[model samples]
Target: MALSRDRMIEFLKRHDYDPNTLQSMETKEIQEAYQEVTKKLLGSYFHLTNDNKSIKTNSILLDMGELTEFKQKLKDCANDVITLIECLQEGYMKFDYSEVNDLLAIALKDMPMHKMQKISHIAYRSFQEILLSQIATALKGLPKEEFKVLEEFYEKRRNDTQFLHQTIDKLKDPATRQQILTMARVKLMVVKDFMPSNLYDVYRDYYNNVPQKLELVAKVRALTGLYSKEYLKEMPFEELETLYQDILKHNEQEEQDRKMFLKYSQAIQESVDNNDDEGFNEICYKAVTHLTQKQLSMLVEYMNGQNPFFLSKFESVVHEYKKKLHIKR
Candidate 1:
């Protein structure tokens, strides 16, 4: 598929290329320009150095076709980051990290150790401040004495090369390394609120098996909305385990609710097709009991184009149920 012109312009402008340059360029020229700019922006992550000789000797080399694929993978990550930032701004913190994880795995295929190290160094240098600032904002409510540990650790990681190397070396053990990666993936799947940079810190703490002040455990538990980070920091390990269990249970319930709603939606559609008002009313009644107000509203919206009569009946059922709940309260 062709890239959207506006998105191409935005991407070019982001990399300091003037949008006006495209005015004189044909579509093919614009596509080539976008590809060249993408490679220039993302090349450092895969290439050890810009010098051809050095890249050949020290980096995992990709042919032209492979490089095109690699660029798309990096572009996928860039797009995910943009979506994540927008969602964060809108107060929807949950995200599915699996797609990004798969993309990164492909993008990093055959990447040399030195290249990985270089990418880590670049991430630390270029992205760490933004990540730390975001973390500070999220954890601002915590006591200064407690928050200081997190602040100091990030500062040391950036400035103290020895400390950083020592920390990285701890992951050299194959079993420990696999365990850390596995834990990071599992946490990403379950926690659902972490940014990419946050996974870096998560891997470090997971390898050490030490509970840092802002470690995944605390972050995951805090996301439950049942506890503050301040409270979680002091909470017993057993209680933390309980909170983890609660999170799993809540996630399971949500999945079940989603499946139920989908089934009812399909049944409603079938009822509409058959012109069965009786079946439609019955389905709406049962759906209201199983689905939340928001879910019911979504169902109403979905029905609007399918059958206006059914949509009105579903709305009436929803209103009646809500009124009954209010009276019970």
Candidate 2:
């Protein structure tokens, strides 16, 4: 029941590790690596609790004695993992198992190993997202004194930015400039709560409008550049303002698209209930047009339990979209 070294190496590399280093490692070292990656992948959703203590999801270390045990656990515990993700995504972070009993039952049905692998990958990704969102929620719920501490740190970050602007002129070495830019990028965490009111408003808009959490760190990282200080000096405020306007326009369009999607989703549901193929096709076509790629992926996964007729319709719609958009799916 030994692990397939090839498969393990593939998994590690997919998560951005250097497979060469792993190749030379002994059994214990490989196990440690597996545990570390597993905790990282699961850390977000498993550790959430309604407590003052900081969340720690890393403690769920895998203890499979051999590959047989490992594969068995992956198969057996798959549904529970999916159920936990579903509940957390729905904002039920601390609910009892009874609440998800039916969902677990449905998820436990037989499936191909490859399909299970896909679900496992999705569950890991979804957990990471849920964890980030939970961390933001925790920050917002902090006590008044802790909240003030965040504000003070944010002020210090602003002062640091000014200092960097002055120092950038003196930093002639490329390496030093790069180091300073990295520090500045790390400091960008301050933006998460820098203007408390604005952050709250942004989160509110995200929840009310989008189906998923906005990846603020990623978005801000794009705004923060390599040699970030120099980039700011080179880019004119007029251009920056235009970029902001474009973001607003994109968000507005997304909202409109979601509205269209909802209308068609409801219409499709009614068509299914009434056994109306023509109505279903008409509504589903409209729905597919409004769906983002991410939404389409989720919809395909969700159709597993539905009737084959409906599932085929959705698959056809997704396939056409992928061809048109040149998506790799």
Candidate 3:
């Protein structure tokens, strides 16, 4: 979306530009004025904390009220970005270079040129701290060890534009890119506001290439309990689908086993409480076939400790069953 002339006029009006003055200016002139005024307004929130003679020049600080107001403005900007991202994901909207540039200009308008240049080294890293926080959230679920490495890397070379680009370029493989895109989409859904427009464009490209795969990838991740990028990169889509089905069957079988274990355990306990030797033997005999080896061992231990008679009866039943199996063979 391009910045409309009417939108620029409206913004100028709120900042005390006269309606008549704005109306007389050309669109380009109004845009330039808007940028200038926006910067000044944003910069007004900061005050120099150190004397001009001090060696440290970057001592800008915000007073309490200014900090509060500035935070609210960042929140507003974040909300707008969230909306734009949602629209882009839904295929109802697209972001142009000019619109993205306009958004970036507004976000960093308060910073000095040198600071802005360093921050803008990475297209996504150029936003304010609040927006960077959103990126952090999007990149969550990376293995903690890997995430720590990423954090350390960013902290070390954050100002090194060449290194950042080179690192990003290395992640050009489709599977790795899709993994990142999937994480961004999932995490961003829960985030309230603020993503850099350029980062949003990256997400847009993912959607354009593989619109339907995101949902399937999310489902496969949940089913297999695998969130690592390496896992996704190595597994093909067909394998993911197969693994999803296999996991579902395994889960269902486990659930059924849990229910059967509970049912037989209850029945065995009841028979023991009633002192019904016949019933206890019958329940144990039935349980042996359904329960796992560990479960049967536990039952044997419990029966032996609780009552000698029950233990004797259970052992007799097992012996008889084994004799019958040997005869059949």
Candidate 4:
């Protein structure tokens, strides 16, 4: 079976996929391939890297911390959030993570690595620990003259909203952010490629364990009328299956969610037509709702792993939907 290239790309990104390193490959060649494809998939966020680590640069608002400001929009748009909640309160929705990954990678290519690291609940924790430790350590006993360079970097990032959010009591110094990133690269330049599966597995466990949080997340659908943008940000597919199945047993699941879930399944029958691996990722992400973790994992794995990549039969099914969308467009 063909692994969904777009989906794989996203998984890599969310997992901090070191685009520069693949198993048994040169960093330059691997980075080149990703840089080329990312230009198409991610748009302009892609940038050349002198050192291996440092990640992407934030272009939109100028600071790595500005990302936290966007969260305000989500809260302020209560009606929108409620609409999303209402739909989800009714049934299980399936979403794919890959689409969210794509949206994020492209959107954040020019975004700060510090903020990007904090985007996912799972990744966010790591982002904070990693960046903070790097920065706090980098700043210890630094020379005053060097602070001039640090001052320049901070000036570029002083007004970031996301930064304020993460450091509600303080603003993350942009120079510190950048320097910490640089330091991280110096330490980790050699280690790259697929992240350890154990990290993801633990992420899945945390996601499954948090019932109140999951319910609250589902509320985001009702509150905003929009499903989560990233595919299962909290855990892996196997984790979702287990979580979803367990939740399904607790109560009578909504019929509408079932319908939406089924429709999503039909819509994403194949990868060729889906285009946005992240989009499918969003669907599968939503789909995991109301299932036991095992069930959620099983269903998602089946959707991503079992289906034929671009079978003619699947293509014909897509043609039918494409015609309708064409009319709508």
Candidate 5:
């Protein structure tokens, strides 16, 4: 039995594939192109991560926040299709929808596993937008001087709009859009690796200062049996000597823990710089135990740049770590 053009397009769209991409390929090549693009898209979906959290489920279940963002990205992705059609109608591309559809049907036969990969790249793009937004928010908390440095960094590259917007107004060719996206990802990865150091400095100060405030509260609570500052003036100090001593002991231990963490972080950086694999591994083991998703991303970027093969090693380590920690989607 021969497949109808309309039926083939329906199957592709139902499985979240971009049917319009067929227009870009020759009549005899649509099947090969569809198969290749679908495989690549599925692979991307399998590796999808948000803040170091792996998404391993076969289906996407988004929260309200994610749903809203996904809708916007889907809209943006759809605009590309509309723009392509408009350009083609305006004589930019010498093809129409009917011709492409007819060719795609003849090329694409019945294929199973289409429903299993229902999530489209457009949805994944939205997820990426959320991840990027989180990264930007993390970077925004840098100290004023460091933030100024980032601002200057952006200012330096402000005029380079070659890959800034993915809209059709700038990129008329679908192939060029794909090529630019590939290059942009590499630059984004490098930026992800470098920008976190400034944020880490600010976070380190926060981690150090918070314990001081906690210590002060502990001291006040010990002496006056009061946890609020408003009651400090009215407290009768009978010198609760034992209580004061206990508070001091606890604060000392807390300070020691902070110092240990600082030492470990320093060791990781030194290990990377000096090419000390064992030392880096030791510190990374300790650091990964407490690292947030943002920190893990930065570390991956750092390691990947140090050695081309390190990205796979780091990913394997993280996979094991996630399993050990029982971190699920």
Candidate 6:
């Protein structure tokens, strides 16, 4: 958090950071060192959002002085990635979360940590570059006004890459992953009205096809894998939807199902109390795997489509019974 020149100097000295010697190095070399410091203190898997939301796919920032130049830079970057994602999507679903994460990690090399990539799971690199490329492409498709509005945030955050790096390192557990999704949905709110029912189409086309959202999917998958052991390891949408639909049916006796549900609930509580969302997700995923298809399907549907209601009620239940469960530290 401390960005003071003196502090930076002291930090450098403590770690043998030679400044006069650094001056002799190429700008790229110095930049890399500065970035390394940010990465060490911050992290590699987060984004800086201006709205102060925890983990959302919002826009990149731009300083007042550099607004115009930053805007142009963004236009260029977006063009590059959108074209790339389009090519990538031609053969596979553009939703390959790991590949997207890889893109973002690469684009964020010089971003500072005033705010950082606040992800819960490991984010692959290259996600941001792909985003940058997408925006540029989208800019060509929309009216100038729409393009400006759509890209305003991207410009702001992209410019503040350094801060985003730092912001990412400070997040706590579930909050970390939830916030990124929150940010993305916020971005969607800007254009959700214009989006068609086939949201995936809109997502593939005009949307900034960055894996920002995929980070959450990946988190969910990781959590699911932890519990189920065999589930969600490499699941795509069709397979996931099928598996989730299967969770909705409950054919077993109420007592049997209830006991199984309780075990899963307790596991969730354990993870939350410990601030371990990944752990909670695994338990929940595994529990559903054992459920009759109908029961599993219902739960999965709620999770995928009605998350707010589910998460809110789940949080309430946890708080109400924390004492009874002896779950709090």
- Which one is best on TM-score? 3
Q: TM per model?
A: 0.29, 0.24, 0.36, 0.18, 0.20, 0.17
lDDT of each: 0.53, 0.47, 0.53, 0.42, 0.44, 0.45
Ten residues in a row with the worst lDDT in model 4? Answer: 43-52
Residue 96, model 5, lDDT: 28
lDDT of 6 by residue, 1-329 (tens): 21444444544555578768764666565545654764543232233333435344455553545434433343345435454334333212222344333443454444443322433021222444444455445334444333444455565565343334334343334465454444444344323433435444434322322354344345455434433423442344555555544443322355575665556556656676687866765665565446777555545454535344446644544454455457655
Q: Comparing candidate 3 with candidate 4, which one achieves the higher TM-score?
A: 3
Q: Candidate 3's residue-wise lDDT over 1-329, tens digit each?
A: 44588977987897789999999999889979867765454243111101122232244553656434443444345435554333222211122223344444565476566653433333334332323344345446554433443444355554443333333443445565455544433333312122344433423333322434455666667766646634653455566567778888987877776677678768878987999878877887787776888667766776577667767777788888788789999
At residue 320, give the lDDT of candidate 6. Answer: 48
Report residue 143 deviation for candidate 5 (angstroms).
Answer: 59
Residue 72, candidate 6: alpha-carbon lDDT: 39
Local error of candidate 4 at residue 254 (angstroms): 13
Looking at model 1, residue 132 earns an lDDT score of 49
The runs of at least 3 residues in candidate 6 whose Cα sits more than 4 Å from the true structure, single-residue gaps closed, are: 1-234, 250-255, 259-329
Q: Write the per-residue lDDT of candidate 2 for residues 85-107, one digit (tens) a residue.
A: 45433322222223233233344
Looking at candidate 2, what is the lDDT of residue 287?
A: 57
Clash totals, every prediction: 0, 0, 0, 73, 0, 79
Residue 86, model 2: Cα distance from true site in angstroms:
59
Q: What is the lDDT of residue 173 in candidate 6?
A: 40
